[model samples]
Target chain A: MTLGLLVEEAGLFSTVQDLGRQGFQSLGVPPSGALDPVALRLANLVVGNPPGCAGLEMCRLGATLRVTVPSLRVALAGAPPTGDLPVLRSLTLREGEVLRIGRVAGGAAYLAVEGGFDLKPVLGSLSTYARALIGGFEGRRLEPGDVLPLLRHTASSRRERALPHPLPAERDRPLRVVLGPQADHFTEEAFDALLGEGFTVTAEADRIGLRLSGPRLAHAGPPEIASDGNATGAVQVPGSGQPIVLLPDRHTVGGYPKIATVITADLARLGQSLPGTVLRFEAVAPEQARIALRRQEAEIAALAARLHET
Target chain B: MCAQPAAPPALLHDPPRLLLLGDAALTVEFAAAWSPEAAARVRRLAARVAVLAAAEEGIREYVPTLRSVTIHVDPSRLSLRRLQAMLRDLPEGAEATAGEATEWCLPVRYGGEQGPDLPEIASTLGMAEDEVAELHTAGHYEAAAVGGYPGFAYLTGVDGRLALPRRASPRLSVPEGSVAVANGFTGVYPATAPGGWHLLGRTPVPLFAPDRPGRPALVMPGDTVRFRAISPEEFEGLWSAFRDGRADPVTACRAP
Candidate 1:
């Protein structure tokens, strides 16, 4: 049985994403995936789908999807809905039903279906990289008339469930980071300025990166480095001295000096921060960062196990 | 009668430095300056690491740049310290054998609407437009790095006389297949997007094809590339054939 949804009003910007395309960065391809992996996983879990299944990632302004089949199972995760619509819970929509997701409280939101989207994977991934105009639904944002095909779900997969707790939202907190391979490029004052509070996310922020504006970081040497491989969450300080936090859709390599990299555990929080949000940074040791990531993974595993038991 | 001249003491002027990029990635840098010696070391190390990664279970991916290699790993499966130790212990001076390099000849249409900046670039370099194209096509370049955009390659080997800084103001959108140069490196725009490099020509060959399985990029790091000038009519013919699967943009050359 085939399931589908027709786009009625595609909000700000929404696209289908998975865990990102891997093993391709060596060829200059960016891993364009959901900004918040935890949210995407949670949404999929609630809908009885695998954690890495493709789902819809909507930006601040939400979208409206019309169910075309007799019934469909879906769940929302990440941002809280502004209206009274239930989120972080699995719900079934009948044929001819309309599901409206209002403006999100955070930077983005994820909507997952029980059987996931039935789109062919491009380059081994269903994630969309709009910059290169490849992957996803037509390799671009969702349009009003686009019809997204959904894989048919088994009867056992269509049960209703709600998250034990509300999914965490992007909060006003210090984003923890690890001083980087080029930390020595910046002066002591610059380091202090970066760690201190005051940087505000600029409007230019997108899936590619979040540009921060504040004190200009002073460079001990030239700000340019030989072009090198870049990682997600790398806080790159270019010649202008402003810092740009690389994201999932960031270029495979860059030439600017990266003073620090935001720890993996905090990337979701960073992903949820909207434009104009004031943020600060705290440096941690590489060992500590590893421990934090392990802890996060353990927590997610425990959550999944508990849900299964329930 | 001759003992291979003591294999000219392996170029050790620049030692590789290993640095932690983050908790999950490590970068092995060979040298700050771009040179044949540095490029060789990078390729050698990358090859060694690829073998090591195949034997190990933790390495997720490895990307080789101009003079360095970045290795990504799963922090949960492997410790950063352990990976670093393994990299440090890799036997050095494993030169990349000559048999590994592949040569490709890319057909380009120089000047006209396809390359609007050709005249400006030629005038700036104090050379005629045809001379600029000839100089560009004459050199043999190595794909030092890939990334800036998907399938975008950074090729080294442009003559020093033709080297020029990037345009002060970048173009909002450069058409795909446009051959451009900047800061001693020549590259082709894999897709239409904003770029700061000076355009000298256009190629009918598609640099990137996500639809292709296995190797999506036509040009990969470490491959050798040469440009052959073609007329606009020839470009159209080749491009149509490529699109229709009647021709290949690249043809294999005899092993050098």
Candidate 2:
């Protein structure tokens, strides 16, 4: 019999996601992937899987699973959900065992299994863009009673693996931003508002964008631009004067002006920041942003190297 | 709050601006406004970057709009300044390539249930329904850029006379294949989506399919499209043919 995870509860908005689909942005397909790459990568490393392998991303809430696999290695990370299972450490679940995770502490939870699930990749990824019904398992959220087959069926037990150092999943820190692809569109005072008073994350948060409510950034001329290409974490302010930080599932092009792009190093913080959470921004030079990103990449790499089976 | 700079008159006279987008990408802005000339410039630069991406492992992917090209690169693998220099050094006089362009002829049924906004669109333009349809079909449209949705191309070259602003309030769900117009651009809804455009007609053809062989996008950048009015009967026949896999829009496309 094939091994699988029988979903007892599908949770709020759980979906399988990988690193992202690349090379299709020109075709209007935004790269939909894990919102917090740091946690997902660490979880994968702990499970002795490739750092970017496809895995289950439990958002807002977490799922209850019945393990049908003879032997399965699993790791939990991202959002530090209320669960008895250890986070950032890999452990085995035998056949007939049940795994349950409760409502998440941050905004989301991530669970990585050894080989992910057996599913056909759409456009070279398992990442779900549910709006377009593309990729992931049937390109939609997991429903109750869904059975996701394991990619690898293990016959024997494997040793546990864990990371030596805790990978930071910061939530309260100010998100670092690199200003402009359109910064000049806003008044200089807008910068002060963005970095000074900051914004509060609204309930309208999703994989597509984080809608924030704060002081209006007055436009120099008009709110709209000749719709241009989008980058992940682009903070776009439309005519209403509210800012929406475009995320992983954002449109490939947007009509509003983007004042800043949150740096790569701060995506984890952004991802974990829940609704009503007060968020702040700090402008960094592009060079500085790159250096901060490099440091994070190096740290993650070092941790991945140290990820060993016990 | 976010405000990107306005359309400065100086930007028109100044050289192209290479702006950093976060740490992973850089965008080369050729113009602040959308124009055919700017679109041509964008096409040329995108083609050049495609060649560059082949040689530089750092260049991950690129999305070319009508006025700019945003190239995503790996920070560890490529320096933003070096990439900017490479872009600046490349000659900007390259002709916009139309040699490989395919012009697709689409059949549409105007002013019906699928196009619920047709009456309002015609009345807003102060033209009869047929006159509005005629005006729309009289122009040759080019796919300026593909965004908003996969295979959904922003078809430029709408008849200036037929140009109308978007609806005061967008519909929560615009039907798939609905032909829409707004702010001088025309687009077909690849799937049912929230939209503000004025819908005037409907097409029976599929707009996007991820597993599609060859090019996944039915309409691509620089590709041209022309529409012809069809009876409701024809629309049904085509819809049935599409459902039966007998109609292929790819086969309908020809050399411009």
Ten contiguous residues with the weakest lDDT in model 2 chain A: A164-173
lDDT of 1 by residue, A176-291 (tens): 88898788789999999998857999999999999999999988999998888899989999989999999999988889989998887888888887899998999998889888
- Cα deviation at A245, candidate 2, in Å, is 1.1
Given candidate 1, what's the lDDT at residue A134? 77
User: Across residues B129-248, which tens digit of lDDT does each residue of candidate 2 receive?
Assistant: 899889888889999889888889989999887677888999999988999998899989989999999898999888888878877788898889998899999999998887688877
lDDT of 2 at A165: 65
Give me the candidate number with maximum DockQ.
Answer: 1
After TM-score superposition, the amount by which residue B79's alpha carbon in candidate 1 deviates from its true location, in angstroms, is 2.3
What TM-score do all the candidates reach, one by one?
Answer: 0.93, 0.94
* Per-residue lDDT over B171-195 for candidate 1, one digit per residue giving the tens place of the 0 to 100 score: 9999999999988999899889899
Candidate 1 Cα outliers beyond 4 Å, as residue runs = A1-3, A153-158, A167-170, A308-310, B1-14, B92-100, B250-256
lDDT of 1 at A283: 93
